[model samples]
Target: MSEVNEQMMPPKVVLPKLEKNLYEARAIKSFLLTAMVWGLVILASIPLFSVIYMLIVEGGARLDWEAITALPPAGFETGGGFGNAIVGTLVMVGIASAISIPVGVLAAVYLSILEPQSKLATTSRFLAKVLTGFPSILAGVFVYAILVITTKTYSAWAGGVALAVLMLPTVTLAAEEAMRQVPQRMRDAAFGMGCTRTQVIFKVILPTGMPGILTGVILAVAGAAGESAPLLFTALFSNYYMAELAEPTASLSILIYNFSGMPFENQIELAWAASLALVVMVLFFNILARIVGRSKF
Candidate 1:
């Protein structure tokens, strides 16, 4: 029994000691790599931080209630605001969103779910990828040629159309990718339960993918909101408040572009403030996208 117990006992454990020099070398290499990564991150962040700091210093000085709620001043005028531009931006963006979201989401559904292997779907996906890199100025020119010329005036409607064109590709591609991320098991289960394709898409896939879809939509909206060139060609910058979408409209980007070149100091200050406001708006949309992306179905 004693012999058996001895045989069953675990052998004496041993841990080999690592060489001090080799351990030190590995530790140093890891530290150096970590430092390099951090250095690169900080170096890349410098420009972004500097721009934000500059905006706060310059724009914060001129940002106030009047800036938020008053009209922009003339070149010689000293105390006015860009309230009309704010309203115009919201209206145009709203129009763009209204036009883009449903169409884009539905197209994404067709591409990712209904007819994914179809030649038309392949062509659409290719064109969408191409449009992702398509120049913003070209989009502006296209809208100018089509909507602006047909309307006989630069209007918010034209600007919204231009932005919609720019936004569509983003929304479509992102939503399609999001829908594809839905697990195949879910689709199979839905089919096993005798659910129709449309029913499965609407009831199972869309609900599961809502967070990602919202993220894409918000990101597209953020990109569209900051566009200046399209609005320049389409809306043409109104001085007074816009009473309708069919007329010229003010926007923060246009305001900044127009005011930054002026000889007047106040207008320049207003431009700075508008730039700050525009940045905040874009940042807010980005943050919203992040929050939505993290949400549960």
Candidate 2:
């Protein structure tokens, strides 16, 4: 009876040992690859960190509330600020955003949802892609000829138009991509519930893609804010406050460009401070985009 009971017991199972040589070889390769990737990342970050450090050291030294709210100093003046430039920059950027966002978003909607495969959409998409690589100076020149020359003066309106052209392609492409990412089931569900195409777009697609659209708009605004060439041709420069959109305007970028080339030390210091301020504005827009992207509808 004891022998029978012993025979009925389950047999012991032994697991096979893993090959240490193979495992160690894979582990070494993985470690080496990871080390190489980290090395490359650090290498790429050097220039960026260096630039930020330089800006902080040079630009930060001159940044102050007075600098933020004061007008640009004259060539021989010792104590002045760039308040007008800041205001002008904001005005022109706001104008550019107002002009570009509506037109670009509409174009994006047409291309992505309404008639994606149409010949007109294809041509437009191609043109927009081409414009993405278009020279910023050329945009300035085009607006210069069309608006500045026709109106017989450089003005914030011209600068805003030039910026709008540069911003349009980016906004259109980004918004289209964002809209395309909307799930097909969402569209189907909307339709199944008796929603019209336009209704679906406004209610479902636009809300879902708002974050991406905002991101593109903010990026375009940031890019427009830093552009000196276009503003040079279109807005020229103003020492005093801007009175109207039709008047020449001051901007942070143009201030930096003009100030940096001056023989005066004070203006050069103002340029550094303006450069720092422009960098901060761009950083702020990027942060806003991040926050918008993470928010739920």
Candidate 3:
């Protein structure tokens, strides 16, 4: 009777043993940890959003079409555009780039292509490093000596010259790095093709390094745009017509400074608007740099 009962019951099912996947478990755990870290970082952007919100709230009311299109403030007017400051900033920075870019590129080329054991290059490189660390206020003082006190006037030329000094190290370093990135084989090939050292550098190396050079210029321009100390001493302040190059020339940054310190709420609002505009201008250049760097020569 017992045998018949066992035979009637279903046979016990057998299942395959599960493999222990320690590696996959560990991988999943690591992925979770990384995702958590990034998630926390994303949340930390809340303050940045808040600041943007405050800026928009305070500045938006003052950013009407007329505020954007009107000329510089006239004798304590509540609302005025920064037209002259904008133009002056552009002209001064343009001149600064004109002076600095060529000299910087030349210096970079010399460092990359000239004597392998040059004491001059070493000295110049050390000086550039020192200059990079120099405080902006010190640069302003230097310009003050050269362009303001000695010249006895605050010319736009003086401001441009000050900006040139401020920009030189950045351009030189960027250009040198770009030059270093040029493949040695290309240089060798150029030499093999009966090209002179100058020809190879100017034609092949420079073009390839154009990306870095342009990046340097953009950074320099951005830096010059935000500077206040150098401009303060060299350019001083002006609320009226755009002064001569040898006289005080107000800038957007200078205006922001002057306006923000006022007791008027409207002036403070203008400061915020101006600050936003400056940030946008810098961002514009950064975008331009990316576009230029990616373009085919």
Question: Best TM-score goes to which candidate?
Answer: 1
Per-model CA lDDT versus the true structure:
0.95, 0.93, 0.81
Q: In candidate 1, which residue ranges exceed 4 Å CA deviation?
A: 1-3, 17-28
Could you tell me which 10 consecutive residues in candidate 3 have the lowest summed lDDT? 67-76
The sequence of per-residue lDDT tens digits that candidate 3 reaches over residues 1-297 is 999999999999999998767579787898889999999888998887887787678766676666555665644566777666777788778878999999999999888778535999988888988888778888888988976888898878888888888999988888888898899999999999999988999999999889878887788788888888888888876765575677778678898898888887767777888777777787788888888777767
Off by over 4 Å in 2: 1-25
lDDT against true structure, model 2: 0.93
Question: Cα RMSDs of all predictions?
Answer: 1.7, 2.6, 8.4
lDDT of 3: 0.81
Clashing residue pairs, candidate 3?
155-245, 155-246, 156-245
Per-residue lDDT over 135-210 for candidate 2, one digit per residue giving the tens place of the 0 to 100 score: 9999999999999999999999999999999999999999999899899999999999999999999999999999
- Deviation in angstroms for 50 in model 3? 3.2
Q: Model 1 over residues 1-297: C-alpha lDDT tens digits?
A: 999999999999899996657458788898899999999999999999999999999999999999988999987998999999999999999999999999999999999999999999999999999999998889889999998898899999999999999999999999999999999999999999999999999999999999999999999999999999888889999889999889999999999999999999999999999999999999999999999999998
Alpha carbon lDDT of residue 168, candidate 2? 97
Best-performing candidate as measured by lDDT:
1
